[model samples]
Target: MITFCKYALCFAMSIKKNNIRLLQNQSYSWLFAISLLVFSSLSYGQDTSVSQENDANKPVIKDDFEWQIILDLSLIYGPTIIAGIEQEKLSEYLMPGLLVDISYKGFYLQSNQRRSHVLLGGTELGYQLFIEENWQLDLILKAYMQGYDSESLIEYGGGDAELLAGLKEREVTIGAAIRYSQYFEDALFRIDFAYGSSGEDENENHVGGLIIDSFYSYLLPYKNWDIYLGAGLSYFSQDIINYYIGVSPDEVLATRPEYDAEAGFRAQAEIYAQYPVSESWSFHTGITHSYFSNNVKESPLVDTNQTTQVTLGVMYVF
Candidate 1:
């Protein structure tokens, strides 16, 4: 008994040491990101000053924020596939609900499409922290859903004794994100870091995680249409993967064993097009595909390793 106790204590100490090291590394990464932003902003400021002096005779375009305050109005409808679910007949296909976007100057808010039956999609609000001709930065807030409410999953054995005896409502994750965008003549590159927090998972359990995403996009303009292609890689923390997808010991049954998901990566690609129908009306459509990593794919709750999303809609600029 004494030897066992000593071994347990040593294991506990090792875990604590590892946690501290992880925290230090995260802090260093954040510091480095902030430093880069500050340096870029200073350099851009000086360049802007020089350009103003060179173009003194050119008429400055006054921002019409006071006159045209509201930014965008749109309506979108589309059929999308929700992948990686047990009940394909009920949860695989869906018609997206209302979509809206509003913005002013550097601040914006938008709703995104749901990719899974377990999720309620999310709302993203962002404010530009810094902007220049080729570089821009934003601070963002996103409200994300982690799992399906028991009521919604009733068809998939929500209250059944064997499969979902203790299922509950989806956990909401509110994330604070930082985004950096770089613009080229016909391409754009973006990187994002987000820290997510969750209050309770119906069991009153607190959860938190982090994500990092990097993407590159290219545009092709032909006639009245502009087409875009984009690709990206995403990283999710272990805490997030576990809370949303992993199975717990108590919740495991004969068929579903306990699972502990680790930090993982995902790859994504998208193609979209926009065509102007008139001065105020425009049509837009896109399709996106995401491939999950083995850590996520190994979950018993998952049925597919990849998911696809498609949307078609129209927008009105006011």
Candidate 2:
């Protein structure tokens, strides 16, 4: 009985030891799994923080500005009168002008003025919708007024009894246009086209026709300056000129005029350089050459065709 009791104690001891080992192995396995889970979560959180920081440092792009303005002046020296039977010498005239461009987001207002045979003022209100980073489309309503002094009119009456008549004409033009601009490392290119009809009795009678204008410009590289070159062409029918000049085929025939203009065209070429000294100040110098068709140059009564002009001015941009 004693030997059997001793053997039973030994067996009991061995079973207890094996059971403890098994429990320890299971506890270690659970602890390892929990640790691995904690490490994975910590790694994910760190990556998220890094990503958010990068996003916070990203740059923002702004496509709107407060306002901009441009002023221009030109000295026009050319033939003020041309007639078939006679020709007039070239004369010089000072044409000072201002242009203001006010913008808020996509809306804009523009006003311009110049002096020539007539003092002219022009205004436009438009909405500029940006299609891309460099391209914009505009829908604008434009109006212009041309006022001339009585002395500016061609004298029809002879010497002491000469009659001087002054006239004021105005026109409203509404049009839509697309403008495309491409930016380079140091230069910019812009191209635009616009078409509109004039609305005024005088414009309809004398200046009536479709008006189209376009421009192309390339900026100089690496300077606060740019050089631009452009050309323009306009055609006017007999009806439009007759209304302003007071000479039509019927009227000319009735008066038996020795020479007269029937219809005409005007062409222009221009080159200018602009330098910006500050956000609100600039200097500009330019030259313009204009040519008028034979119909206008050969007319006996009027002679403002075929002229060349040069101008230098300082501008204030707002």
Candidate 3:
């Protein structure tokens, strides 16, 4: 216990020394990055529908294409450390998104790939390389890093608003990915090897970058409800890290200095619960926590090493 206390003390001191946090806010300006993509569909809110391999009871599609549509409405409340936070303030966001999944033969396009794998998010445009009963492989273009505009900076918690002003807008990072997914009766696993490319954002990053992601989700089917537990780990090369959190030489200030981000890792875990009200409507809620390593935390542009959020929503399948 004494050793733990000492370690905790040292960690606090390190954060203070590194200038990692200006203030803790109830929300982040990058809310779209988390809310829009992460909880876009019924996969995170409502349960997914999948056909098992070797099961002859599945229905055959009579059309030239297969499609699924989901509409989601959610309220997200969270604690964030952004560039500005001064008062004791928290934020709540009402987020809405409509997702479509369409597949013709082995070619597919998805707005929320979360339905493909319980632990994955964002858009996926891909061609299936191989598909067997319980496993599948694909070549894909995957979008991950959520984009943010510079013009809409608000002080939700506490920090210097100027720190986020006058910066070029950041765009979503879409990269080429080789992905593998495995489905089980009550669980899902996925892994991806991605090579990032240049984004449309004004800021430019170096070339030759890699990102690795692995995730797992387990479902607990209670008599009256369904619960999903998930965890994920991602590793990014220096170039990829720099694009999201780095401070260019030209944008440096006395308070927000230039920061060159190094290769780092992010960890995420989530728990979601759903209660069905009818054949097409359900109540959903979830809590997610994401953490960054020192390579990201040390940057002056980053305020906290971690963020936690809770979501409440409803889902409708059409």
Q: How well does each candidate superpose onto the true structure, as a TM-score?
A: 0.63, 0.52, 0.73
| Tens digits of lDDT, candidate 3, 147-223 | 44444333222335667765555555667899887878777887889987645323343444788877777777665
- Which candidate wins on TM-score? 3
Clashing pairs in 3: 84-158, 84-159, 85-157, 85-158, 85-159, 86-157, 86-158
User: For each candidate, what is the lDDT?
Assistant: 0.50, 0.39, 0.58
Per-residue lDDT of model 2, residues 58-103, tens digit only: 2112237755555543333322332221112111122334566666
Report the Cα lDDT for residue 266, model 3: 80
lDDT (Cα, 0-100) at 210 in candidate 1: 86
Runs of candidate 1 with Cα error greater than 4 angstroms are: 1-106, 110-123, 144-146, 156-165, 199-203, 316-318
Backbone atom clashes (below 3 Å) for every candidate: 0, 4, 7
Ranking by TM-score: 3, 1, 2
